[model samples]
Target: MLYWTLKYVLLGPLLKLFWPTKVTGLDNIPKTGGAIVASNHLAVVDSFFLPTHVKRRIVFLAKSEYFTEPGIKGKFKKWFFSGTGQYPVDRSGGSAGQAALDTGVRLLREGRLLGVYPEGTRSPDGRLHKGKTGIARMALQARVPVIPVAMVGTDKVNPIGSKMWWPRRIEIHIGAPLDFSRYDGLAGDRFVERSIADEVMYNLMELSGQEYVDIYAARAKELADAEHAGTRVAVPMQEHARDATRTPETEAS
Candidate 1:
């Protein structure tokens, strides 16, 4: 298969030789059966390296743009992404979350390992951000365990806004599988779903040792962009008031 050949033969050897990755807790991943591999989004290379280190195949829900490029080079890009066990999903608008949940549930039901970043987007400042509840909903819908993974030093290898890849050491840490069977049959409850997602993020914070922020990474990026452009984006007073009282558990949603 192309996935195996790329990981073990083509890109894998070159990656190992240059980056020299260190992985721990490989046994935490289930050798058989369905599970969610929830990780913190640090860099674009996080996706490329995580799958290479894990023995089991990991299918990531990537942005649709990756597969929708134009021309012959675009065709090759689509082929490489698809052949590497990655699927495309549109990540725009409100419906995007639901679409991702549906895709993930289908993969889990098929007894496949689904790699997801609960933060929804990469950390703009390298700090772990609040997780969206889609991950919890997927686990509940599929009745699968959640495995928290941490990728350290990936941001250095390929940081945001950087085109060149640095030959820095990377570390992949796999934590113990987290069971959410206690909330079985309660996936529809928003409160319970948020709690499940918060628990997963808490584990990731511990494994990755990154500062945990109880705000969505996308929103943070928006505010950051506005600041950088010297444009004032008004924050509603009520929203600020609510943020003052926001708890970590409730923010995970």
Candidate 2:
């Protein structure tokens, strides 16, 4: 398959030759069956490096725009993504988001490993952000264990808005799987979903040792962009409630 050829024959060897990636916790990955690999998104290459290091093929739902562009380059992009075992999903929220979640659940039900970025978007400042509940919903609905993965130094390799990829030392830490079977069939409950997502984020925070922001990465990026543009955006106080209630040990560094 193209995935194996790319990983073993082509790109993977070149990446390992230059990048010097350190991966821990290979034993944590399930050899068979379905599960979720929940990771912190840092740079665009996060997707590439994460899967390259893992033995099991991971499926990610990439944004549909990547598959819809018109041109020879776009056609190649679609082929490459497909060959890499990634499919496109509409990122538009509401029904679209639900559809994507359903697709993830279906993949899990089919005994496939699913890669999810709980933060929804890459961190603008390299700090872990609050996880979206969609990840929780998918895990609970699929009855699959969630493995928290921390990708270190990927941002330095392919930095935000950077065209060149540097061969930085990338570290991947895989934590033990978190089980939410006790809350099975409760994925529809918003409170339960939020708690599950928070638990996943907490594990990621501990593993990655990154400063944890209680706000979603997308929202944080928006506020940051607004400030840079000289436009003040008011952050709702309710969003900070989770931060206020956290213990001192779990406080953002």
What are the Cα lDDT values of the candidates?
A: 0.82, 0.82
TM-score of 1: 0.89
CA lDDT, candidate 1, residue 207:
97
Estimate the overall C-alpha local distance difference test score of candidate 1: 0.82
Q: Model 2, range 133-185, lDDT digits (tens) per residue? A: 88888888889999999999988998888878887899999999999999988
Clashing pairs in 2: none
TM-score of each: 0.89, 0.91
Model 1, 124-178: lDDT tens per residue? 9999988888888889999999999999998899878887789999999999999
lDDT of 1 at 197: 86
